[model samples]
Target: MINKDSVESAYCFLHQKYRVYEFSNSETQRDDIEFAIASYVNDMNKELYAHLAKGRKEFLCNHTTFAADMQEAINELELRL
Candidate 1:
């Protein structure tokens, strides 16, 4: 039952944690930001999938979709930058 609001909130939290605004002025900086966010999301997906595979019932049933949504957000941010 993960909602859009929750996804957005998580993205905002990660956005702040990663200091994404620091890379707002140039192509290179934007690329760096995109790479950083992608890497972070990749790590998160790995850990989440691992837990899901281990039969962790608490893991979201739609985690792959959640990861995709996060990735789409990152791509949109990169485009805006």
Candidate 2:
């Protein structure tokens, strides 16, 4: 469901407001970004949890696994970008 539009929206939002400097550092900003991502992931996992409650084992597994993998890939790509 994370199509190009969603990615662009997230990237643009972060770029315009939350994106950090390359050399200068800020722990609070880092923490804020971490919190934001954690919150987003928590919300996503709640839907996965609901699916699990409904006995959709395959989808639950696939969704969780794919999400984790996608996050890792995105993290790597973010560094590269």
TM-score of each: 0.34, 0.34
- Tell me the number of clashing residue pairs for each predicted model: 0, 0
RMSD of 1: 10.5
Clashing pairs in 1: none
lDDT tens digits, residue span 1-81, model 1: 434554454456555634543435666765555555545544454533343235543232233443344444545444433
**Alpha-carbon lDDT of model 2:** 0.42
Q: Model 1 scores what on Cα lDDT?
A: 0.46
- Cα error, residue 81 of model 2, in Å, equals 13
Q: What is the C-alpha lDDT of each candidate?
A: 0.46, 0.42
- What's the TM for model 2? 0.34
Q: Write the per-residue lDDT of candidate 2 for residues 5-32, one digit (tens) a residue.
A: 4444444533433334222277676555
Candidate 1: which stretches are off by over 4 Å?
1-13, 17-19, 45-81
